[model samples]
Every structure is written in C-alpha cells, then in structure tokens.
Target: MRNYLTLFLLLFTLQLSAQNHVFVETESFEDKGGWVIDQQSFVVMGSSYLMAHGMGRAVKDASTTIKFTKKGKYHIWVRTKDWAPFPKGPGKFQVSIDGNPLKQVFGESGSDEWKWYDAGEVDIKTETIKLSMKDLTGFNGRCDAILFTDVPKFTPPNKLEELSAFRKKLLNLPDSPVAAGHFDMVIVGGGVAGTCAAVSASRMGLRVALIQDRPVLGGNNSSEIRVHLMGDVDKNYYPKLGRIVREMDNGDPGNGNPDAKEYGDARKTSIVKAEKNISLFLNTYVYKVEKQNDIITAVVGRDIITNKETRFEGSFFADCTGDGTIGYLAGAEFRMGRESKAETGESLAADKADNFTLGTSNLWASLPRDTVTTFPETPWALQFSDEYHIDNTKADWEWETGFGNFNTITDAEKIRDHNLRAIYGNWSYLKNHKSQKYAKQELAWVAYIGGKRESRRIIGDHILNQMDIQEGKQYPDGSVTATWTIDLHFPDAKNSKYFEGQEFFAGTKHIKVAPYTIPYRCLYSKNIQNLFVAGRNISTTHVAFGSTRVMRTCGMMGEVVGFAAYLTTKYKTTPRGVYQDHLPELMSILKGETIEAQP
Candidate 1:
C-alpha cells in the first residue's frame, strides 16, 4: 500500500508539471494596431492593459498568435472591466480563438474594478491558435490579460499577491536580481527634466542610467499624455541650460490640441540614444529602493512587459521622477499639498496646512470635419447641471480634477477614471443635445495617461518659496532660471456647484513674477546624502512650485543637476560636497556653456 501511494503521488506531481498555463498580456503584443496602452493607473491588476478607444465606432481587431504545447480543451479567462456599471455598459468586445468567436462576450457586464471574467471553455485541436479581440463598442473597452490552461478547475488568481506569484511562476522569472551594470548616476523618470539631465551628464563623461516607467522617454511631453513644453528656456542667468531641451522640443507653439505630428516623441528619443555614456531603459518601472543610512544604494526596476526585475546600482541617484517615487521609497523627508501661512510666509499660502495640490489632466482634442460624427451618450456619468452647457468640443489643460484632499499617487486610477467619466459625459451632452455647435467635430485623441502637475516634494537643504521668486532673491549657489508665471490651479467654483465633489474643470490664478534663479540647495535631498531631485518634485513651497512646475523650467533644473552630478563623480564627493567645496568648479562649468536665447 505504501509503494502504491508513493507511485500515485509521483504521477500526480508529473501531471501538475505537464500542465501548461499560457498567459498573454495584450499590451505586450508587437502589433497593437488601434488599441492604445493605458498605463496611467499605477496600481493596476497587472502592469497595464490595451484600451480600444474608437470614440463611438467599432475599432480594428487587436490580434496575436499563441503557441500551445498540446491541443486539448482549455479553460479561458479574460481580465476586463465594464467601466460603467450603473447600467448596461457601452464598452463591449468578443474574444476570437483560432478565428472562432467565443460564445461569451466580455466588457459588457462586469465590476468596474478589474477582475478575471470567465470567457468560457474553448476546444483547441491545433498546437497554435490565433487570438483576437473584436470591439463591439469603441467607447473604451480594455483587456489586461488572457489565460488558457488545460489543468482541471484552473483559475487565474484575482488577488494582487496571488496574481504576482502566478506571474512569477508562469514567466519563470529569477528569484534573485539581474544585474543592470554600474553607473555614476541613475536618473529616474524620463520627462523633459530627466532626459536633459541624462544628456547633460553623459556629455560631461559620467556613465548615466536614464530609467522611465512608461514605454516612451517623455512622461507628460510624450504623445501618450500630450502636454506641450511650457516656460522659457535658455534665458535669465543660465543661458545655455536649455540647449538640450531645445533639441527635443516639439517646435510648434501649439499644445497637444494641434496635429499629432507636431509633438516630436521620436526626436527626444534620438537625442538620448546619441549620448554614448547614457543607458536608456524605457518601459521599466522602479518599485523598490535599497538604502543604507542616509543614502540610496540601489533601485530595483521591473520590466513592464516581461515581468523581469533588474537591480541598478549607482554612486549617485536623482529623483527626477516627477512623483518623487524613489525618494518616497527610500523614506526621504517630503511634503505634499498646501502649506500653512506660517510655514513659508507666502501671501497666497493657506491659513492652515491642508491636502490640496494642483490637479492632474487627461486632456482631449477634437478635429473638425465637414461630415457629422456621432458620440455615444453616457447617462451613468456624473451629470452636469442644465445651467452648464459645454459647447466646446476640445478639452485642454483646464480640464482637471483630484484636488479634493486625495493622495494623487495612491489614488491615481480613481483620478483618471473621474477625468474619463467627465470627458465622456460632457461629450454626450454636447453631441446629443439640440445644440449643433459640435455637429462636425470628432475627438481625434484623448489621453489615458494622466498629466500630473504636483505630488511629493522631497525636502532639500533649501526650499524655495513664493517670497524667493517675488523678491527675486539671488543665491550664491543659484543654478537654473525659472521664467514662468506663478500659475496656481484650483477647482473652478462655478463647476463645483453643478458636479459637487467631483468637479472636473479647474481655473488658474496667475501671479506674474520676474525671471528668478533657483539655488543648488533645492536640488539634493537633505536627509538622503546621495539623493538628488529635479523637476516639479524638487523642494519648493506650493506657491513657489507654481512657477517652477512648468516643463522648460524643470528642464533647466535638470541641466544644473547633471552638472552637479558630474562634479560629484570627479571629486569623489556627495551632492552637498560639490556645492560647498567645489562651488567655483561648478560655476566655471556653467560659465563656459553660457549662450543667450533668441529674442
């Protein structure tokens, strides 16, 4: 009986090993076609999903080929969401296997929360099968992942922890870190700021690693989020600071509302690739930071597509990540939202400290055509009162939300959903209403990636405030020059009356300030010795952030940080050491690169 039991146990283990579990991430498909990858939401079921955003019409089928070990009956589960579950949702799609459409269609009925919906069983006779998603309504149907398994009662894990383990097992990922080589400086986040920092540092003979969470290098400037470059560059004190920024500029003065051709997503990429000392890693999100007392030692980045983790070790680390992700993970001192009047003594400061930061935007643009286009009605959305009739077809920077006391980092997905719902609902009213103002308009594009303005600001040796810009205070260590107005955005009181807590429109109150210099002390962390920061996440008061948050201004800050980092490497010292002991050397480098901007 013991021998029989041992044989039975061995057979069961073999059966389990033989069972093939194939998981295909739709976003990983090489030929995405009309399906756009939605990655704005940080905490998602998996990395991200492919979204079919055909406005109102049905979209082209997103198809891929999957090879199986053997042909047999397979249990299929698709990860999808209804998006609007108040009633029968508009977003719907059907999965086709081996050119045969499944009996069960997905995206029409499911929880708004992402979950694995059983796509019913499919009988596969061939070793290879073609998988396709046919869109029924192009309102915004999405698919995160698809699973096919022959194991009995096999179900894809729904909980995040279980799903993570399942992914690791299925991908055969290494338990230990994969070495990504060593670098002098590792710059996280690849917006205008991070890109410039990488380029500048590489030019100065420092081995640099430029890591971006998204597939593209430009964060907000990329076509995914679509915000045009703002603020004046190559001016004020640091004339040549924006030379790298100019190389990647879209060139057109127009925002993302204009033709897609204007935004040079490829131009920025070419600039980075030309730098010999810079190693650029796109579609790699840094989730973990390894730190020694007061210093970050390494950061672990996971590949968005392959589910592989790589450890990047560097002498110096820059938190160019606009959200201050690395700093937060390293337990660096940081602040978010508004500050009390006593905190910074700015005229516009709040009476008390509160959680109110500039909102994020999921902007939309519309093209006018001679023929009429149809947009579906989204009655389930947060309705705008009849008093507010939105006749405009295009949504720009003003279309913002998430200001109502919420953590923009943790609640990113919810914020994005609110923006989407507002866009769809407002469009529905404009198109279906008796008014014919938008009769010939069609939405060309809408951003699924949220264009954020503010988040955690890492505390540094010096925190710039409204008084700094307003008084034009000059510092001995001043590096970058900011020339934009103190433009602060708040929830529009008029819109709030109609939508209540979920106001979408934001109004900007601008206070023009003279072009002022930002100090070197504002660039590096106070607590974390080797940490440096740039972009909007740099240490600054809320009112001061209004002026420095613009892209071009942030780009200049990056240029200075890049120079400072090079000095740190050359002198074998920390960021603060470069400022105190090597200020003259740093200033000499800045003086050599001085070239005036064109009038």
Candidate 2:
C-alpha cells in the first residue's frame, strides 16, 4: 500500500511541474545588447522594460539564456505597447527562441495601453534555449517581459495589480522586503540637490543613504540628459550654503552638447563615493513608503534590473526626487500645476487654476562631419514640410513638450516619444529635403531621458511666492539665496501654428528680480514630520519655482536642508521642531560656524 501511494504522489508532482510556466523580465537580461532599461513609465506600467533607442538604425539583438525542465511545446506571450499607434507604429521587433525567429512581430498592435500579445507556440528539443529580441525599426521598440507556459489555452494577466501578483508568484519573490540598513538620513534622489544633501549630511557626521534610480548622478545635468547647471551659486545670503554645489559644477557645457564627458558624470559619482559616511545605492527606484501617523518610518525600493526589493529605515528622510515621489507615497500635502491669482495673490498666477506648467525637454544636437551624411525618411514620425519645419542643427531647451497636454509624471513616456518623433521628422527633412545646407551635418547626440522643469510641489510650512522675491521679503530662517530671473516657459506660437496641440518648441520670458533668500520653513514638509524636500519640488508657487527650479539654486536648498537635518539629529526632534526651536543653530551652521553635538 505504501509503495502504491508513493508512485501516485510522484506522478502528481510531475504533472504539476509540467504545467508550470517560465517568466523572463527583459530588463533582467544578462546581455541587453543595444537595448536600454526605461523606468520613466514604471509607475504606470508596473515595471521597467527594455527599449531599443537606436535613433532610426536597427540596434543589436538583446539575448539571454533560459532553461526548461522538460522538452515540449510551449506558448509565448510578450508584453509591449505600440507607442505611436496612428498611421502604423514604427517600433517593430521580433522574438527568437534558440536561434529560430518567431513569426509574430511586436510593437505594432495599434494599442496605446500595455498588454500581452500571443506569439503562438514553439517546439523545444533542448533544456537550454537562447531567447532574444531583434529590433526592426529602431524607433523606440519596447518589451517588458516574456512568458512561456506549457499549460494550453493559458493567458497572462493584463491588469497592473494582477500582473504584479503573477510576477511575484512566478519569480518567487519575498513577501517582505529585505532590510537595507538603518541610517540618519535616506535621500531618495541622486540629483544635485540630493547629492549635496548627502555630502553635507555625511560631512556633518551623519550616516546617509543616497538612492538613485539611474546608474549615474547629477539628474538633468548628467551626460544622459545634458542640461548645464544654472542660477548663481557664488552669490548667496549664507556664503557657505552653495560651497558644496560649487565643488560639483563642471563648467557650462551648454545644453545639448555632443560630448558626454563635458557633463562631468565621473566627477559627480566620485564626489559622492568619496564621502565615507554616505552609502550610495545606484539603479534603485523607491516605489513605496512605510508611515506611522504623519511620519515616514521607512522607504521601500526595488532594483530596476534585478527586481529585488529593499527596505531603507531611517530617523529622517529627504524627498529630492524632483517629482516629490517620496512625499507623494508618504501622503504629504502637495500641489501640481498652477494656482489661481485669487488663491495665491500673485500677479503671475493664472486667472483660474488649471493644469498648465513648465514643459520637459529632450534636447538633441548634430555635428559637422568631414563627409556628407544621409538620414533615412521617418514615415512614422511627425510629418513636416519645408514650409513648417524647424531649421536648426541643434535643439536647445526650445525642443520641449508636455506643457498643458500631458502630466510630467504619468505621461512621461508619451512626452518623450512625441519629442523623438518631432526630432526625427525635423532632422529627416533637413538631411534629405535640403541636403546642401546640412549635407555634412551628422546626428551626434539625442537625449532619451527628458529634462523636466516642474512637477508636484510638496507643501511645506511656507510656500514661496513671486511677491516674496520681488519685494525681497526677509525671514529669520533665510537660507539659500535665489539670483536667477523668474524665467517661465510657454509653447512657441509658431510651432503651435504648425503642430497645434502637440507643439514641440518652447519660448520663455525672463522676469528679473533682486537676490532673495528662501526660508528654511520651505524645505520641510508641512504634514509629514520627518520629511525634508529640496530641488524643484520644494514649497513654492509656480512663478517662484521658475527661479528656484534651476540646478544651482536647488543644490543650495539641499545644503540648507542638510544643516537642518543635523539639528534634528542633535536635538532628537522633527524638521519643524528644528525650525521653531533651533533656528539659531541652523543659522549658525549655514554661516560656516561649527556646532558639534555633545557626546
């Protein structure tokens, strides 16, 4: 009887194993080839996917090795979206198993939403198989994940929640995240603001963890995006406030420079790595936060490629993500877009509150070559005639998008794609239509990462406004000085006449103002006790943000926040407590005075 029972159990286990499925995340591929991991839409798409950003030329194949338990027929499903669905999508690619290319072409389903497409079935004779994706158009083809299952008539989940659960179940991920480490401060961004904060806090004898989603730091000023640091760092209310920011500046490379080294990616990385008290975690995205009442207890981040989740606990946290991602997750009070003139009492404020805000730019540049260069016709890109096309070799901040038509955080991928179409179409016309003028010009660099201007402004005790700058309002908690003009951007009227709703060009008018200092109260969240916000997301009206949003000014905000953080740790109080109770100590630290805590 015992022998018979054992035989039945063995058969049941085999059947279960045979029906199992294999899931492969494209971002986790060992060899990604020319494909790049894009996490801009991760919030809406559920995960980071691989994108072939070849700029019109087909990229090298992205391949990985997969193993199967038994040799049999399996069905395949690929998660992808046709980024440009109208007039046929340009991003088309094919999947291959063991060296045999599949018949189904991906990224052409005419659907804007991300969904799984069935790729039929294939016979597997070997346990080890080579899986790969071949880009056909090189117009930003994307693949999220691939699934192979032995169970017949099986379909993968399409909804975000269901898909997330399915992935976890299939990947066998832990229910709880692994503890990263306890820290005095956990900074959620690696931009200039966050980098300065980490450096300042670390130098002040606090253990810091700087988490950045991308491989490199400097945010928009990095080589990936290539925007130069602007605003005045040398002229400050507190002379010592922008010292750290000045140390990281790599001279003005100008926006959309072709050379990557001019952006100083290595210099920024080394600066953070040199800090002994700072533990830098690159390529980590923070998606969730743990909160107790109004205070954030911890933040949960996942490895963009490996998908491993980590819990970072800290006594205090800083929201320097520019998008205010940490503050949003922690339920901190925040505002997006513009405010009404009646509400804010500012002259620059709109008559009524709406979704209008500064746009995002994906700058591109071309260089003169020794020989004539040719570019392919982009039929799938935004069509432009000689009468209505931009006639420039390099695109500066003028090549912008997502002013009122899209959300900077949710529709980031769409905005980026629109910018690409505009860029390619314009360049094609310049190269092919009017070859004489731009015959020797070759496309040098195009930013796949969009340089954003504004997003969610996490509300603090004080919301800086336009009058405060024009009037030069003084506060006892004056910190970082703002010297840049209130430069606000709007869609170019000429481009609007041609592109209408999808205008890609931008125009800005600079409103000059005397140098003014931002209050320290504007650095910490009003609701969330332990939260500190810097960068463009700090408490500010849309007009005030125009000046404060610049990288140099934002970096100084980080320096002030860092000093305030030290006061919090020394006094064992919240950010507000430090502002109300220990303002003198924070002011002293900002003035270059040393105030060590008693042991």
**Top model number, TM-score:** 2
- C-alpha lDDT of all candidate models, in order: 0.83, 0.90
Query: Over the stretch 1-599, how does candidate 1's per-residue lDDT look in tens digits?
Result: 66765574556446558888888888776667688776656454547678888866788889898888887888999988888766656678889986789998787784787889888888888888889988887878888889998888866777665576566666667888799988999999999999999988888888999999887877788877778888887575756578888888877545556465567778889999988899999988888899889889899988776667899999999999899999999998999989999977888999999989888898887888889988877876666546785667677788898784556877787787778888888887877773467778877877878889999999999999999999999999888888899999988888887877887889987899888999999999988999999999999998899999999888888888888888888878999999889998787777765422111
lDDT of 1: 0.83
- The number of clashing residue pairs in each candidate reads 0, 0
Give the clash count for model 2. 0
- Candidate 2 local lDDT, 1-599, one digit each (tens): 66764574465346445677889999999899999999988788778999999887889999999998778999999999998887668899999987789999999888877899999998889999999999998789999999998887888878766677677667768989999889999999999999999999988889999999999999999999999999997777677888899888999989999999999999999999998889999999999999999989999998899888999999999999999999999999999999999999999989999998788999999999999988988887898996888899898888999888999999999999999999999999999998989999988888888899999999999999999999999999988999999999999999899889998899999999999999999999999999999999999999899888999999998988888888899889999999889998889888888777322
Question: Whole-model lDDT, candidate 2?
Answer: 0.90
State every prediction's TM-score relative to the real structure.
0.92, 0.96
Output the number of the lDDT-best candidate.
2
Q: What would the C-alpha RMSD of candidate 1 be, to one decimal place?
A: 5.0
